[model samples]
Target: MGMRLYAIVIYLFLYLPIGIIVLFSFNAGRHASDFHGFSVKWYGKVLSNPFAMDALTTSVTVAFITALLASVFGTMAALGLQQFKGRFRALFDAAIYIAIMIPGIVIGIATLIALVTAFGYLNPALAAAWPEWLGDAPRLKMGRVSLIAAHTMFTMALVIVIVRARLAGMDRTLIEASADLYATPMGTFWQVTLPQIFPAVLAGFLLSFTFSFDDFIIAFFVAGSETTLPIYVFSSIRRGVTPEINAIGTMVLAVSLSLLIVAQVMLRRRDRPAA
Candidate 1:
């Protein structure tokens, strides 16, 4: 009884704020705290707001691209690492885990410094090397490219972990049979290995998209002039909180929960016995 009570208390402590946000999202009042009556006008306002829409578009685009890149590169890395020997494999395993464990602030700062340094050197060199005919050489800077790159690098570790977990449980005999049957490696992967591991890859992609979409720390540093949904919300909150903010939070929460549920379902389905 004591443990149950404690658990309930802990859960409430964690979720009460989220519950409040969801509840107040429908508040008719202009203030976030004062709930005059239930209305969804705030949600409509949020959806119609041009700045918010632009930020949402940016977030969705970046998240989609980030997920795609992370899935592709991470899957490739996971497949390649299977062939690696002891120490090298262990080293890479540590690196992947460390990338995931590292704090977002550290990643954001490091990415910012790295991009700034690289751009400083590359922009000048590129301009110097450019032909006089082409008006001005394009310069590298912290923006969408950097944002996508940072997000991909961070989320790729998650993909590697998920895909590798799937790979570890895969039936090796199927692969052996494919090889014995004189199937090319590429052909075998396309027909056999890929089908088995695809679920995990997809789950990883969804998780990557969710993370990239919700992220503010890394995006804050590398976003340059671009604004993501999280960044926009953060900026908005600096002025004052309103029901619209609550509505935005509720919408983000809904999206994040939906994706998470889908990812969980995919993973569970992957674990089921063959029909």
Candidate 2:
């Protein structure tokens, strides 16, 4: 009874603020401190706000691209690492964890500085190499491309970790059987390995999408002119929180929750025995 009560208390402590935010998102009044009765006016406002809509679109596009690129690169890296042994494998594994363990702020600052310096050096050469017809297309700088690269750098580690965990648990006998049947490396990967590890890849993609969508620190440093949803939300709060901001937060929370649920379902399905 005591343990149950403690667990309940812990859960409430963890989730009460989120509950309050969601509850007050529908508040009719502009003030978040007091509930001024329920209304969806704030949601309407969020949808109608052009800046907010633009930010949302930017965030979704970045997250989608980041997830896709990270999933492909990470899955490939995991497969390559799985074939290695001993010290090399251990060293690579440690590197992946280091990326995951590093603070986001540190990563953001380092990435920003690195991108600015690299672009400063490379942009001149890139311009020189460009065709006359292109007419000096804008060179890469700190913007959407930098943001996507930064997001993929960190999120790819997460994907690798998830897919590697799945791979570690996979049956080696299946691969051996495929080899015995004279399957090519590509054939074995596509026909035998991919289907088995696909659930982890999907889960990693969803997780990467969520991380990129909600990320603020790295995006803030690297985004330059482009405003992502999290950056917009932060700016709104800095200006002063409104009911519309609350409504946006609620919608974001809903999307994140839905993705989590879908990922969980996929994992469970993967774990289920074949009937």
Q: Judged by lDDT, which candidate is best?
A: 1
Per-candidate TM-scores read 0.94, 0.93
Tens digits of per-residue lDDT for model 1 on 1-275?
A: 99999999999999999999999998888776677998989989999999999999999999999999999999999899889989999899899888999999999999999889988999999999999899889988888989999999989999999999999989899999999999999999999999999989999999999999999999999999999999999999998877788999999999999999999998997678534
Worst 10 residues of 1 by lDDT: 266-275
Badly placed stretches (over 4 Å) of model 2 are 268-275
Candidate 2 C-alpha lDDT tens digits along 1-275:
99999999999999998898899888987788877898999898889999999999999999999999999999999999867999999898888888899999989999989889998989998988888997875688788888999999998999998898888878889999999999998999999999999999999999999999999999989898999999999999999877777889999999999998888886676576422
Each model's lDDT comes to: 0.93, 0.90
